[model samples]
Target: MTEQGDTHVKRKMPKGVRKGGTRFPRQTLGDSLAWAKKLVAKTHLGPQPEGVVLSGVVGNSNSVGRVRLSTLKQFGLMEGDSKGYIASDLAKRIEAAPTEERSALYRAAVLAPPVFKALFDTFHGDEVTHAKLKQRAAELKVHPEETGKCADVYVTSMVTAGLATLDGDKIAHLSAIDMGTPPPSPLITEQGDTDEPKVADDDGEGPEDETQPEAPNPKRAIFNVNVTLDSSLDTEKLERQLRLLKKFGAI
Candidate 1:
C-alpha cells in the first residue's frame, strides 16, 4: 500500500485595503498610457518623440510629469536615453496586438522590472497581504511610509498590466502573465531491449576517479534575540512574530 502526504502552506495576510482613493505617484499604467497617447495625438505625431520634447510639453508646473514618464519607461512600452523617449518596438507590437494578445503583453510589461518580478516569483503560489509586502520592503531597509506607497504602486502597475489581481488587501498572481516559458509536455516513451556498446580496450580500468574537492568550513557565530508577546498569542500573531524572527535571520 502507498500513502500520499499532503502539504500545507502558510499564507500571510497583507494589511490595508487598496482603494481608488489612495494616492500614488502614478495612478495606474493604463492611465499613464492614456496620457501618453493623448499627448501624441494632440501633437499630430506619427510616433513618440524624445523625452526632452515631451518634458517641454508637460511644462514647468507639472512636477508629477517626470514620475509618470518614468513609470511609462519602466513598463518597457517606452524607452529613453540621452536622445529622449520614443516608442519601443515591443511597445508598438503590444499596441498592434489583437485584443486577445493584449493581456499577455501587459503581463510581459509587469515582469520586465526586477523588483516586481521578484515579488511575483517569491509569492507565486502563496497568498500574501499588502502589509507583508510592505514589511518585506522594510526588511530591505526601505522607509516604512514609502513601503506602503511603493506597495500600492506595484499593485496598481501589475493589475493594470493584467499580470495580477488585487482584492481588498490581498494580492494574487494571475496565470495570465506570459513569462515566455512554455509548459512541459507529459509523454512517456517505452524502451525495449537494446544491444550494449562494446567497451574500448583499457589497461584494467576499474572506474573513473570521480572525486570532488571538499568545501572549506567557516567559523559559526550565534547571537541571542529577545522579544515579548502576549501570553495567549493567536496563530496570526505568532506567525507574524516568527516571520519577524526570520527576517532578522534568527530562525
Candidate 2:
C-alpha cells in the first residue's frame, strides 16, 4: 500500500522536481535562464520579495520554487536571496541579445558557478562521465553523497546550454571556450595593431551569419582539413586566415 501511494505521489509533481537534491540548481542552466527572463519581465527588472520572485519564476512559492530561485542564483542569472531577488546584468543582456548572440551568452551563464566553471575548464573538449564528475567533486571537496547529483546537474546543464553535444546515449563533445571565452576576444596582430576577423565556430558560421552547411557532423571526428594560403605574403586576409586556423588548433 505504501509503495502504491509513493508512486501516486511522484506523479503529482513536475518532472525533475523533488524535495531533496544537491546544493546546486536542480533545473538546467537553460531552463533557469528562461525562467529568470520571465521573472525579470514580471518584476520589471527590479528587486522583489522571495515569494514574488518565486511565484513569477516558478509559478508557485513552494519548496520547488525555492529550488528554482536558487538555481537562478547559482547560474548567476538572478541576484539577491530568499529575502529579495533580482536578475543579474548578464541575464538582462541575454534577455536582449538576438538568437545567435544568445548562444555565447548562454555559455557564459553556464560557466558562472565556480564548480561548473572549474569542471568545464578541466574537462571540456573531452568525454564527460558521471564518475569523472564524482571524482572531480572529491578533488573539489564536495560532499561524497552529493557527487552523484552534482554529475547529473552538470551533464544536463551543459547539454541544455549547448556547451556539450551528444551522440546517442553519450555526450560526444564538451565545447571549448578560452579561459573566459565568448564575446570574441580582441584579434590582435603580432605587431601593435588589431584586426577583428569573422570567426567561425564548430558549425562554420561566422559574424556574417552565413547559411549553415547541410548536416554538418557535430562529432569531433579525427579528420584532416586542407588549407591553401596564397604565396603572396601581402594578402590582407592572410593574417586573419592564419589566426583563425590557430584558433581551431589546426596550426
- Leading candidate by lDDT: 2
Q: Give the TM-score comparing model 2 with the true structure, all chains together.
A: 0.58
- Which sections of candidate 2 miss by over 4 Å? 1-23, 175-251
| Model 1 ranges off by over 4 Å | 1-27, 36-61, 175-251
Write candidate 1's Cα lDDT for 1-251 as tens digits.
44555655675433332223322334466765565454443333434444553554443224456556556666665666535466655566665678898777777776665666666666654567999877765665555556787678778887787666788988876542344554323343334344444344675443476575543445755578777767699989899998998998887
Clashing pairs in 1: 14-129, 14-130, 15-131, 51-84, 51-85
Query: Number of backbone collisions per candidate, in order?
Result: 5, 0
